[model samples]
Target: MAEVAISDAQERSAESPALAGLAAAEAPRAPAFIVTIYGDVVEPRGGMLWMGTLIDCCARHGLNESLVRTAVSRLVGAGRLEGVRIGRRSYYRLSEAARSEFREAARLLFAPPPVPEDWLLCLSEGLRDIDLPLPWARLAANIALAPNRDDLMPVDGILMRAKQLDGHGDLAVLAADRWSLPEVAGAYGDFLASHGGLRDLLARNVTLSPEVALALRLRLVHDYRHAALSDPRLPRAAYPQDWPAEEARNLFVCAYVGLSKAAEAHVGAEFLSPEGHLAPHNGETERRLFQLRREAAG
Candidate 1:
């Protein structure tokens, strides 16, 4: 990825001590609007959206038109949104790479070994105290705490049961249909920002044992597959039966590579196995997770 260039004004704003403190406090308060926009655009068959239409839609959610427009522009600048001009209006869509990144992000958020529900309960309480709208908070909490199934196939059954219990089956189906990568990413980012301990844990555990890492990776894959498959919009035709397995394997490899590279920055290559792998050590949480996954998979 190329480094982003910021203007002097932006640099100043970023450096201001007061603004920095405010940003730290506010970031968690805002859920992933950028990712949500991306998901809204991509979940549909067209995958392209008019900027004006998006602004109007966000307006219904109490977001200022200018704020929504600015957020879209920032996402475009970040390469997550590709701009296409038709006549006088501009349309934005996700690039292929952005889609892949969002897919990985979605997998991470809905994956197994879920985050604790109390984390979101605390966030919702904080938002309530500040008089913030509760829809986003409610939705985030639902996604995070949804029951995990053994595999992807059984997920649809759960969704169907949820519909039967509620009269708004169609609404539930519509909402599930709209779930997408960017939305998941935005929610995950928001959740992480709200929970300080989560951020600290991710930063500190850079050299997780391979066994533990694999377990975490598998859980994430399992949950992602289940979530996506349950959604009405994501049909089996879009993702074949074998796709989940393949994607899961690919994610594991990518995570392993990324973690190993990060570890190499501190521990010398000598600590790595002869085949450039990280072995499990006793007392590592990741190793325990790996064992749990083994039982789950079996």
Candidate 2:
């Protein structure tokens, strides 16, 4: 079975120090990694997966069956996943409550919204725990700022449109003050360093087996998701001169595209919904690959 081959591939990967080291360097928490697997692989093909299939996929990342079960229990408790039983087998799918969150995460991972050029300055005396459209940061107790976007419906608040004057102070300093830019940069840097070897190895025309390719692709998305989601994704003008986002994004595209063919082979063979095994290509999957390929080419 493909799952057995992944175990074999892990043993063989020891012969390649780069692959071995990369594998051992990171073991993402079981719950988050499960979410990544679902978002990237399960959601597009069909928003469901068999428990046995999920456990097999998680095993590639060194998660034990017990750990995955515990993680799934927690996700169900958190309303992120819901389970169904068919005969004696268990199947799970994204909960309706969590679909929006998963969709947002997918957008960030695949097709992130561009930062608007204009700005919105919101003032509210009673701003407590409110969900304004994302990428907004609280400047003060009663003031918040976000890029002015028209697509999102307006929230209940006093909104003002503002523009940067011709002569402006450094926006990067302001951005740094408002958000955790240093931490985000460090995450991106670590991702680049940790995965650059694999990227280079692929560049040399080295081929990977389907199992190995799937593992690497999963790891790639798992690591990049942390950095990308943490980012507020402000306008380019506000970014620090040395921002590594673009560089990280470029690497993500290259690595994802490079690993996708073989990885999809593994997915088609292994990833299953209650209906059946996932298709290798679908509208959602095709859209993702098409966009990433264009970006890689560009």
Candidate 3:
């Protein structure tokens, strides 16, 4: 599952200037990488990861050790992570306060979407943006639609599910109308162009260092996440004649599948126990990755 420790959005993680300069040049903030460390790697490990394990994992993704160290300390201080010293080594886990949110985030990040029972048509004129229980698209200065039901006359705005609406059209049209297609498609296109190159490079059997493979994997997933997660799961009729989401998704799966083997090898090597045993594949990552491959293939 992918997530950041969230306070406001019930998402995201720590904030500090220690990682500012490097963040500007490299990947996301150290805190963000820490979030990745949790969602992509650590959360699967019973919410605990060895300190050295984290240092090594983040390094593969291009984070500096010192920055990671700082972020870890900041997280511990901020009550996001609990550190315990076992023998001569230290391990970190999600704090009691954070575990529930992390688990909820995992459900969204990892689990397949349930069959659509209903869609919420949220109208907010003064509020501009509304926060629904569903994932994605909390920021737009207009009405929004979601594929969930909330049966209460909320104080903020009207949460209208399919039953409440008098009119009807293709459900895809609702999704298409609620969001800006041009903006969404443009993002999808840009990611596909880059990810398509990654697929080609991987197909060519180009050699990549562990660090380079990790970086490519993370960037590919992160950008794809930004575009795809925000999508309203609209039907093809909702998009222009040729929507790019399917192509983008395939590129993501292909690139990720290509990068995963090497990346996992690097992780296993890096996350050794004090007894020198390699970290075991917990199977969750593999399960999700294989499912995605199947989705791409299908």
lDDT, candidate 1, 163-247, per-residue tens? 1233533533333333443454444343333322322334444444332333233333333343333332222232223333334
Q: How far is candidate 3 from the true structure (C-alpha RMSD, Å)?
A: 11.2
Off by over 4 Å in 1: 1-31, 108-298
lDDT of 3 by residue, 87-146 (tens): 988877778776765554454444445435655555678546345443323435655555
Range of the 10 consecutive residues with the lowest summed lDDT in candidate 2:
10-19
| Top candidate, metric TM-score | 2
Per-residue C-alpha lDDT of model 2 across residues 1-298, encoded as one tens digit per residue:
9998997676566437545855577678998999888888888887899999989888877888999999999999998999999988999988876777878778777777777786888898755567555567778777888867654445567999988875678878888877768988999998898778776777776667787788888889989998897777777787888899988998898999888998999998888888889887789998999988987776
Ranking by lDDT: 2, 3, 1
> What is the TM-score of candidate 3?
0.66
TM-score list, all predictions = 0.29, 0.89, 0.66
- Give the Å error, residue 202, model 2: 1.6
Candidate 2, residue 68: the lDDT equals 97
Task: Report how far off residue 141 is in candidate 1 (Å).
Answer: 36
